[model samples]
Target: MTQHADVVVVGGGQAGLAAGYHLRRQGLDFMILDADTAPGGAWQHMWESLHLFSPAEHSSLPGRLMPAQPGETYPDAGHVVDYLTDYEKRYGLPVQHGTRVGAVRRDAGGLLVEADTGIWLAKAVISATGTWSRPFLPAVPGRSVFTGRQLHTVNYCSPADFAGQRVVVVGGGNSGAQIAADLALDGNAHVTWVTQRPPRFLPDDIDGRALFDVAAARRRALDAGRTDTGGLASLGDIVAVPPVRAARDAGLLTAKPMFSRLTASGVRWDDGSRAGADAIVWCTGFRPALSHLAPLNLRGPRGHIPTDGTRALGEARLHLLGYGDWTGPASATLIGVGRPARDAAREIAQLS
Candidate 1:
């Protein structure tokens, strides 16, 4: 059925759930559009050995606490899925699962959202796909020649899947290090971490919660033009962490040339060292996945739709969350998504 809502939230992750609740509280009629079959977008596809850097209770949405089982070390991907599923049920958030928004257009009438299913209209649109939307694999020489079973980190689930195989993990990011460590511990595989950039490991928290990168608070300070005044380090600075030292010492990591393209045999590095790895896991990163948005006249560098306040675009209405520092934490987090959702809901309510 073709329907119109006061708001149409894209990417039904924690951000979308939080927005659904806030808008409902304001009595705005809206529907959340998600690519996932259900809620818990990325977590559902996360590495099987994955656990949150923080405790489960700490990562819960605003209204509810993520109930942890006895002796749980933070929440694993499974635990988070349970929590998010429960959140959906508790609030009765309207969701269109398996519906992917293809492109977004704006006009005087309102916002036009095109999805794989059909078209949707709303007073405002929120993009909670987060910065990590697309998996990025660096291009190098002879990429096609690599005759190894290679996969992006997005498809990774469990260490057991790569059991007894020689796996080479590329990239120096948190995901790469964590997965390599887990594969070694669980899969009984020969895991090698090859990255051009060195990585730093975060210290375990007071209660020994493994610290992953939480850059929300730091972004707020940077957005306010205060990065030099002790704000969070930019992307360039995250590499300088001391954890890189710790990871190297643990024999879980190695320094190698930038990934050249695949070769028929295995993989080659920029510096010319090669490994005949059985499997290659790319933990690189992502780009905007809006290949469907072919003609959305958005105003941002690259594919980014930058925003200032809840501004209007060409012909569309938009209250962009995770685009700027509208409220709460400004980083790409639930903390970041929550505040903007509140603002967007309020703006949409007024427009309606």
Candidate 2:
């Protein structure tokens, strides 16, 4: 049977749920298709020790605020998953789990979302597939021949997995720093941090909340045709959370320049020194999981589909949510995604 709806939200993560909240208020019949068997979306796949840098009040979806767990300043991955599970039940959001979408194509009836379970015929589609599944691993020479273990942040679970190993954590972003710290401090792994460039660490006072504010301010400035005047903190800057701070205090947060190439045992540095590593944890980041929209021929250079706000320039009926700031400012974060999701919902509602 082909399920029909006024709007189909792909990827029932925070962004999809946010979009769905508005759609429900506008009396629009919509369905959220989630790839994960559970409700937490990408958070479920995050490393076990992962915790939001911001407080629970700062990280939330559209209608409901993420309730802070007692005695915890920042919620852990499990807390987030629990919240997401409750959020779905609270709103009774129509989410069909385990229905991974294979492709979305145009049809005479409407946009057809072909899934592993069934097909969704919807007038409008909001792609909220956040970038958890598509972890980016940078290409380095001799990568294919590297005999040591290699893993990306997506598959990373815990420091215990790499216990008593020489682990090289790659990338300069928060994930890289956090994971490296975890391994060296807790996993008892001898860890080396690698970066393309020196990483910036924000003041202890600044967290994800402050970062979002800065990004939002930048967006407002750009929209008003003015220069974005912000000091210090940027997206790439690492937050000095407890673990990171402890690591820094212990002199374990130092980073080395990127290696020249991979070796069978480990990596070759630019200085012609080879360091043997038992595993390489690539915390580089993720690419948008937009494979379902490939049939639309909307992808531009760098695998990004250009958008005017959240609406895809190639197809207006198609709106992209939560991929990144390209679609909407801070659309990838819990608090940040609401703006684009609301806008997309309103746009879809107005269309009907």
- Give me the candidate number with maximum lDDT: 2
Model 1 agreement with the true structure over 191-273: per-residue lDDT tens digits: 87777766544333322121112345454556678744332333332221233334456665654655665677677666777
Highest-TM-score candidate:
2
- Reference-based TM-score of each model: 0.84, 0.97
> What would the per-residue lDDT of candidate 2 be over residues 234-330, giving only the tens digit for each residue?
4447888899989988999899999999988999987898889889998998899999999999999899999999999988789998987788888
- List the candidate 2 regions with Cα displacement exceeding 4 Å: 230-236
What is the RMSD of candidate 1?
3.9
Tell me the spans in candidate 1 whose CA falls farther than 4 Å from its real position: 131-133, 206-220, 223-250, 255-261, 270-272, 292-294, 309-316, 322-331
